[model samples]
Target: MTATILLTPAVEERAPCTLPPRLVLAPGETTPVLIDGAWWPRSRDLTAELPALIEILDPLWGRITRVTVNPTFWPVIPRKVPVRGHVVHVGWFEAEQDPHKLLLLSYTVGRWDLLVIPPETEPAIAARLMATATDPSRSLTATGLIHEAERFRITAEEAVGSDSLREAVWDSEGGNDARRPASHASAGAVIDHVPSPAEGR
Candidate 1:
């Protein structure tokens, strides 16, 4: 019997993600910033990540808008760095109920969301969120993040302009839809180098 040799196909390396110009930070910056519903990854901690992030999103959060982070941000190591604005009155929603995990910023500039999706599924879920933030007409029941989102939410008072976002995952009934089950008990955002009150502005 003669045996035939088979060639194996080499796996191609994924290209570097081309982030939007605005999303690109200076020499050093932390990332995985959930911008306009898209996620941008960075390789380092930034000197002024928040200001730079807000600057890129100026059209949405504006220069002087009051931005509040969930209390979960405080009480962490490094002794509680300060933010541009104060913390919200009501505490954060349980992980089983928060709308977004990257950041729970409360801004009054306006509800703004933009999405540019590639062929990947995770990005598409993020894009769908951005799309839903600005437009309530779109339903997110079909989006990939709904199952995870169903278990995380903010308070009624802190959930301004997020009614649609809260409802998008209602269909999940707090259970997995199709993807692998997600870990839900991780701590909230840990944005390093966020300028202290005196250091910033």
Candidate 2:
């Protein structure tokens, strides 16, 4: 009897990636902000955590694209921290019934910062919204959001804080800044929405 020769095909081993996967998610209200990787755990409860988030988040309620209270992962985001003061609130204000611009107001124990994001549709309106958010005389309730389908909506039960709360990230350092100021500024404006090269696999 002649025995046939058998050969086993070699399995190619995958190389370990040196760089971490870039975080990506289209801006919108949703669960588990990070798309391709692990950030928030599957075992945690969002309902039990909602109240504390609002208490800590205080006045930062608006069109929140993403939020997580007491997240359990090292977020891959470039953020200025409490050293400058954490971002306390983020949302987009309305402009002549259209989504205008993003108004982000950050605060600390004794400090506050106001940074504006464009496609500035109505610079005057954006300035007013910013003023409303930053005005020391205004109450948190007075700065409440307008309900629009195009914008992210936060119900009375869902307001929350931003530490470990990631609503947006960048493909590069200039992702938000590199775009032309004239680009349309919707509630969820993603000027840089392409997936990372690592995600191609």
Candidate 3:
């Protein structure tokens, strides 16, 4: 197994807001697959984004005691985040962690891996990705699924100017082609181990 460096920075605990996260899970029971679902967070702020996710997932999959993510996509990697009444430890592995995936550990459900879709992705593209990631027949890893999605993407021309101008142009281009964006596929790593309570905490 690849070694992971755990970081436990002292972070202030706050109440979970219980907001909904853009997530889609594979139908049926969990099975052996590279990715079990996909999550498209609104932003790269881990501290702000995680509580809502934890609130939605805990009751269904059991209390998530630990969450591991790659630091590449997230700007702020907190040591721990509060959800409900408990704390969830967060960790990161530079080398072996997939930048496009998030690994969650729950004592009841075991380990779960999810594809981390880019926040700026268009809604149409993101919806397709969510469907692909949760398809039980598709066993692609987070990276694999992204590459597959890129194959069908049609990049829209860049609108050079103010943000308002960009939005105006985006609104005017009302066609099927307008819904796509440039490919965001990138290289990522794989993680296979779930740390025991004694070692993870």
Candidate 4:
């Protein structure tokens, strides 16, 4: 199935916030927000909290064609491949009217995917499907968790190396120096305690 993946920067709980005024639920209008790629609460009170979240995530949602909430994942039993993959399911809702869709929130895992539905009612249906999602935590044995943690460490190291290379290239291309500025006098200073050959003789 076709899906769009959106990556959000790490969420900081202490960051400032802003949101829109809560909307009265119309007969056919619905909004939902996904928290860590999962459906979050979508009551009138919860929707009212969207404005503050919207402020923090203003940069991210600007490019989004639409926002969705109550995302679900279904594990695909591999037929030919030995590994299983998860399919993302989502409910589409109007970002403006749905406070759930506008909240700037963070996830434990650093990434989230929003599935924009062409039809608004799709989200409500997706929410039901999401209720059946298998808890990823439950699937991971202790050993699996350990292995995954180790893999993450290795990935982080590789990322650091990649960043260093990029920085070096940028510096070569006259990019801003990341190092602290050095004083001219300090750079030019020299030691002067030499003796002539004749004096030594």
Candidate 5:
């Protein structure tokens, strides 16, 4: 969609701030970023590497507030009843990239969304996030790159089942339930005997 940038007070005061970076969308408008560079594909590897990535980027930027990775359901209609399926593992990092503004790095599985918001731009944050997910590279900065690594981790984790679910499944199979039998028949046998939708009538 449209390019969006958010600048917090910390970033707004900085001289490095340029024309707010446009969210890269069109085929020919993409920024040249090395996606496969430095960062690992696995979440664990990325998590392990985050500290270093932040350290390397911090001096170039300003101060990093926090890096957060969580599942988020972005509602197309804010007040709608039946919201759509969620876009999982929407990763974010809030950093003071400049003295007068805040740099927000928002990313998901497909793309990165960057925003440079002035201290007073809090209300427009959601719109800015949506824009960043469309294209993250246009806002490429030292802080943004650090966040990309974490976003990659979040994406990788979403691909697999959650630890809690995995543990429950594993524990059930390893415990007494592992020996339990079906009340009727095995799944394969049940499938073989299933009636067609038409036959049920």
Candidate 6:
């Protein structure tokens, strides 16, 4: 009997593609808000990241002419970045701009402020922060939203730790430890007292 051997082809590694910007905008209202929306970027590289953001916002908010960021968060800031066929000017400020916020200026639309969620944030925590930041009813600023996110993350970790400890205790004794009451902590407690938007300014 003759056995046939088949050679397997090696799969080629592909370059990583950019993800769509994780952005959420607040409901439009007559009154201006401290923050217009929130953007969660995948990296700190402003040059590499700005094009995708501009492409998404250009049509909805008008042609974005200028964008500004704080030097603290972004490592390298290019003077100008080309998006589509036009050039978008990039500016950086230390004292004037908030580290957690990005300011965008458009040709048709006036100015827009967005909460810049950190690149390394957990998905759950980032989602909560994005929702809160864009909430029209909430007067929290970009900084305030970040503070709230941190608090929420810490609380959630504590809750998980507590749950594990309880499970360990139950395991040590019998599985049917009916006498012990179940304890649950709420993560929403931190979001209840969001600071006024003015605090961030």
Top-scoring candidate (lDDT): 6
Candidate that beats the other on lDDT, 1 or 3, i.e. the better one: 3
On TM-score, the candidate that comes out on top is 6
Give me the runs in candidate 2 sitting further than 4 Å from their true place. Answer: 1-76, 79-119, 141-201
Error (Å) of candidate 4 at residue 162 is 0.6
Please provide, for model 1 over 58-170, each residue's C-alpha lDDT reduced to its tens digit, 9 standing for 90 to 100.
Answer: 54455333332222322211111222342111223334323323332445544322232222334434444444433433334222344533334333333443444333343
Give the candidate order by descending lDDT: 6, 3, 1, 5, 4, 2
lDDT by residue for model 4 over 46-142, one digit each (tens)?
2233333333333443312222342222111111111012111223333232322222223321333322211222444434323322233223322
- If the candidates were sorted by their TM-score against the true structure, best first, what order would they fall in? 6, 3, 1, 4, 5, 2
Show model 1 residue runs off by greater than 4 Å. Answer: 1-49, 59-61, 71-121, 138-201
Clashes of 6: 0
Instruction: Extract clashing residue pairs from model 6.
Output: none
Candidates' C-alpha lDDT: 0.32, 0.26, 0.75, 0.31, 0.31, 0.76
Q: Model 4: residues >4 Å from true position, as ranges?
A: 1-137, 177-201
- Candidate that beats the other on lDDT, 1 or 4, i.e. the better one: 1
Clashes of each: 7, 2, 0, 9, 25, 0
Q: Candidate 6, which segments miss by more than 4 Å at Cα?
A: 1-17, 176-201
TM-score of candidate 4 relative to the true fold:
0.21
Task: Compose the digit string of candidate 6's lDDT tens values, residues 1-201.
Answer: 111221222111212227888899988763688998999999877666888898999998999999988888777666777677787888877788888999999978799999999999999998898888877677887888899889988878966776676555544444555454444223333334433335535
Query: Model 5: per-residue lDDT, tens digit, 1-201?
Result: 211222333322223222232222323345554221222111222123234433433343333334332112111111111101211121332231221112223232232222222222323442343344344354454246446544755655754544444444444444436556554224333233333335646
How many backbone collisions does model 5 have?
Answer: 25
lDDT of 2 by residue, 1-201 (tens): 111221221111222222332111222333322121111112122222222332333444332223312122111211111111222221222332122112223233222222211222244443344444343343332114222211332321133322112234341333456673533334234434534435534
Worst 10 residues of 1 by lDDT: 3-12
The whole-model C-alpha lDDT of candidate 6 against the native structure comes to 0.76
lDDT pick, better of 2 and 4: 4
What's the lDDT for candidate 5? 0.31
